[model samples]
Target: MTAPAAHAAPRIPAPPSAPADALVRLHLSESPYGPSPHALAAAHRAVDDTGTYPDPARTAPAQAVAELLGVRPDQVAVANGSDELVLLTALCLGDRQRPGVTTADTFPGYRICLENVGRGCREVPVDGIDALADAFDDAGVAYVCHPHNPTGGVLDRAAFDLLVERAAATGTPLVVDEAYLDFAPPGTPQVPDYLGTGAPVLGLRTFSKAHGLAGLRVGYAVGRADLVGRLRAVQGSMPFSVNRAAQAAAVAALADRGHLERVRRGNADARERFRADLAARGRRALPSVTNFLAVPVPDAARAERLLERDHGILVRDAGRFGLHGHLRVSVGKAADLARLLDALDIVAPVTGPGPGPALPTAATAQERP
Candidate 1:
């Protein structure tokens, strides 16, 4: 018999390609207009001095952040990004025996850090503030993603007060991730107000969101001097993580208040318009106070794939944060939002009546940070 005919290997289909210029990245919540001109100039200038190592003490950036926040330099702990600060908080406060406490649908970085250190999270429902209070034992750290992640629902003032009071009573370390706080209304209460309350509170702020410096990877934590000192101790052994150029950019970014305001106003307008467009198409979006919104869809994962492959529009599937049937769309420029709306019109056509009022219900809740 002739040698067995050579078997043909099955071929896998290649994914559909999107046009290079048509790609609209609305997934990471980056600033559509990019960094301030002053920040860009400062970063470019600092590039000339890269031959030398950055200040191991991170003095200039720390002082800049402190000045902006009306706190002492000693109270600030600068890091690679807010994500690193989250990990540092977990490393300092998490206990392998006791699970960390956080909202079930909040940012996943804190929980991931805890798990990496042999700890787990005890997640409470987004609306279950009372349950969260009960879970606040002194054995582990508690993370509060203010204005919450995927869903963008902030704890009311009363709920926040309760959380702080309970944490203070239990002597639990509270890590408040305020990465998206800059997008909230002006004069909103920030973490610095609770500094001297005798509770170990670490308030995290980042240059990524409103500051438009995500690529620079700069963020800081503010707290009581003692708490900040603990984080410094943990970060001491590492080489200068925040680079010199990034430090310069962050300092300059903080000084450009006008740029920040413009970004905030533009985002607010675009976010409302995006929500209205979705509503007109029979989709519902949760109320948002940040640079993103979560809209419920028939199948979130499928929707994400379809948007990218067919329309060159990128969005996040909320399933990664334990949310089902929702997509997280970051607020971009007006043109970008228009593109998203046009794409949605095709991929997600309206069928029946539009969804009810934009309130977040159990079936379609998401949080943002």
Candidate 2:
């Protein structure tokens, strides 16, 4: 029998890995707070029912969301998360090769999703909607994440109305990602409130942020009945038959108006204080109505790294959004804010101790101590 030849030297290519020990994360925009106590209790209650498949239609939670927003249950379509609802909605209505789907440079994922579906996206500044009317096709769609990420600014109601009117005029569908709307200033428009205007708008909300249920992954869309049905068909049997527990918690959280108000008030106070602190320290902050503040510094990446490595406190740097001079910090409650502020003070470099011990003008350089 012939013997096998000697094997050649083996080759092992190193796998590409993310940088080691590089901030396990405050980069992801998740709530540092845990879910509500009531939501936890509901999850426990649902554990016994794990033996069975959840209802494909998810009627109960849909009803809960409907009641919360004053819309018919049929008008709502629940999903695994706001992302799911967004992708499904795009699948149902957005045509990447066509003029329908559009988003600003704010979030890349939305644009990526649209591109995946063969739809095109256009980037626009987060100003009045009037500036964006030219981008909508006669029969297309538009998507905007209000209180936009990486730049937290709310387009005024007048601008929202302009968007609705433009969409109505062009027979274009508008998908408004109000995922952070609950954290918006009070009296922000509700799902039904926008729907009542007779414009083709779909409102997306999530339990992930304000309800502190990001891990549970429950969110929904409020839209015209026909539109909701289309998304349902495109989404198939998802809406996770398992999301009931999270829904129950969301309902309870909504009912606890006092708790929600407290959370908002805390965020408001934190945002103002943080901005003021930044100003006192000679930094700029973008105006915002959401639970986060975007601060503009000279070198945001450097600042972010310095804080994480030196102080173990992290905030999101806007390098991904092309705003390399800014960072986004989520507004937390009192203690969290205090911790962040302390970290900021520790990490931010003091520029030359300002004028070096009271320089005496032209005579100062010669007489400096």
The model with the greatest lDDT is: 1
| Tens digit per residue, CA lDDT, model 1, 203-315 | 89999999899999999999878778888998987758989889888888888888899998888888888888888777878888899998887678888999999888899
The positional error of residue 237 in candidate 2, measured at the CA in angstroms, is 4.8
Candidate 1 total steric clashes: 11
Model 2: lDDT to the true structure: 0.66
- Can you tell me which runs of candidate 2 are displaced by over 4 Å? 1-26, 94-103, 237-242, 333-336, 342-369
lDDT of each: 0.80, 0.66
How many residue pairs clash (N, CA or C atoms closer than 3 angstroms) in each of the candidate models, in the order given?
A: 11, 6
The segments of candidate 1 whose C-alpha lies over 4 angstroms from its true place after superposition are: 1-22, 94-97, 357-369
The C-alpha TM-scores of every prediction are 0.89, 0.81
